[model samples]
Target: MNRNKLILLTAVLLLLAGGGWFLHDSGFFQAVRSLEALRAYIAGFAPYSHLLFFLVQFLSVVFAPIPSNIVAAAGGVLFGTLPGFLITFTAVASASLVTFSLARVLGREFAGRIVSKKLSEKYQGVLRTKAPVFLTLAFLFPFFPDDILCILAGLTSLSFRSFALIVLLARPWGLLFASALGGSTLGLSPWVMVPIALVGLALFLLGMKYGNQVEETVLRRLKERRSGDTE
Candidate 1:
């Protein structure tokens, strides 16, 4: 049993290592060696490349710090509203799922190293909650680092079925928010970008803090109730 667990763990590590190497080999890493260069390169593609753009954005989300919002906006600018929206949404979902599962198979310790200390700790209470709705809230919040959170959430007690349902529920708003970023670039008011960005971020923080707190409180109360009944 121990040997099996070790083999599984090794396989997971090798998978992540493979992704890292693939990104490096594909020039995904080298392109972003300079953020300005990456921006210039992506911006230049705004006129004629949709599929390539989507691939870059997807890989960036999975492998680097090239933020999702930028990719979404670029999608809109490149593909023009509808197509960009659809393509960017699909890429984000795919990238998110890939990263989430990678993190899940990799385990909490590996996840913590890659993600933030604060983020991983907060996810623990949710893990203990063991409710589908709790996961939905976790995914719904934009501030939660959706991809990383999904990976961490997998480390929890939630089943694969629950995890997937929460992801589906969370998709529309996230997709819309990102698509808006990309699609918004086409319109007259790039300045309108400010409020949209703020609102999305605000909801993310609000939901993560409040939702997690409420979940923790409910768990505490339930434990008390159970203990009281025992006494």
Candidate 2:
């Protein structure tokens, strides 16, 4: 890369490293495991709690494994549903853009290192295909690895604008739902929550069983359609 691009890449890597270390040292990851703990930890930031929460949310996406939904729920409990959703939506969308841009700048070889050889190989088709249909579905669904896909998308022929549109359209429902759950705006008592929980569990089980098949089906269909158009 040119000097400027190399410098930008270095800066991004350093920021991610520093941010990862800070989150670990601050016990942000541990705190996010529990709703009360996360709420209290963010609350400890006090006058600047929202800002801290935003940082935590942003880092969670870029760093991976921190569970953005749990953090969003904590924001809901701490800041209420609307504020929580807004904060999470902004942080996550920004982080997604950052990862996408990073991969685009760094190319497939570097992205393979970041996401791992196996994952890169597994999703390599994503790089070759320009269709956003599968991407949209993956982002919207609960079972897909949405964060990694954000990085993988950068290696595709998709324009930044197309990817941004997908992120904006497909990413909000889950965050909003999680925030509302934490905010208790649903006002779901045991009677309601019990059935909802059972249904959710059922869906989760079903997703686990067939999610990959569904993804493959979508991709296969898209490829067939593209081939037909070419023919």
Candidate 3:
């Protein structure tokens, strides 16, 4: 890397370290077990509570403790649907971008250290066909290991613009639903919520069943396109 890029990398690593320290020191992970306790703890921060909440959500995306949905839900309980979704969406998108950029700059070898050999191979195979689509699907569904996939995406040839667009658009839907369910004003009744929940569950199950088939189809199409180009 050039001098400027190296300096930027150093700065980001420092920020990640500092964020991790604050998360551990603040007992935010422990507080995640109870939304009421989490909200109350943030309330104690008074004026800085919103900013702190955003930071914790950002850190969770990188650190992988406490699901993003839970954080979005807490945001809803504290700030209502629109503001909560905005905060969670921005924080998550930012964190995902940072992780992806780091992986891109650091290279696949660095990402390999973060995930297991089998999973790393799996991600590499996925990237061989399409990064943006795979990333969008991973982020859209709750069942996927999105945090790890974010890191793996960095190793692909995806442009920052494409990755950023996918993260912004594809990621927010699930979190928005989660936040709405927790929002004081927007929280749906059990009768309404249960069906939405069921649909999400069904999608998750289908993803688990057919994800590999979809990947293989994409890969085969890519190969066909390459063959046609050579012809």
For this target, which candidate reaches the highest TM-score against the unseen true structure? 2
Candidate 1 local lDDT, residue 68: 62
> Judged by lDDT, which candidate is best?
2
Q: lDDT for model 3, on a 0 to 1 scale?
A: 0.78
TM-score for each candidate, following the candidate numbering: 0.62, 0.87, 0.77
Model 1 segments more than 4 A misplaced: 1-39, 43-52, 56-66, 100-106, 109-113, 116-118, 187-231
Answer with 2 or 3, whichever has the higher TM-score: 2
Give a tens-digit lDDT track for model 2, residues 1-231: 688777877887788889989888988878877888999999998999999999998887776678888899889888888999999999999999989988888886457656877777766674466448777887788767788889988988889999999999999998998897777634668787677567656877998899988877766777787778679
* Candidate 2 segments exceeding 4 Å error: 185-188, 219-231
Clashes of each: 1, 0, 0
Cα lDDT tens digits for candidate 1, 59-145: 655454655655665556555667766776677667667666655666665566567788667556545554465556545554345
Stretch of 10 with least lDDT, candidate 3: 106-115
Model 3, stretches more than 4 Å misplaced?
A: 1-11, 185-231
- Note the Cα lDDT for every prediction shown: 0.62, 0.82, 0.78
How would you order the candidates by lDDT, starting with the best?
2, 3, 1
Tens-place lDDT per residue, model 3, 74-176, is 8888889888889998899898898898888877545655667887876676665567767777787665678888888888888889889998889989899
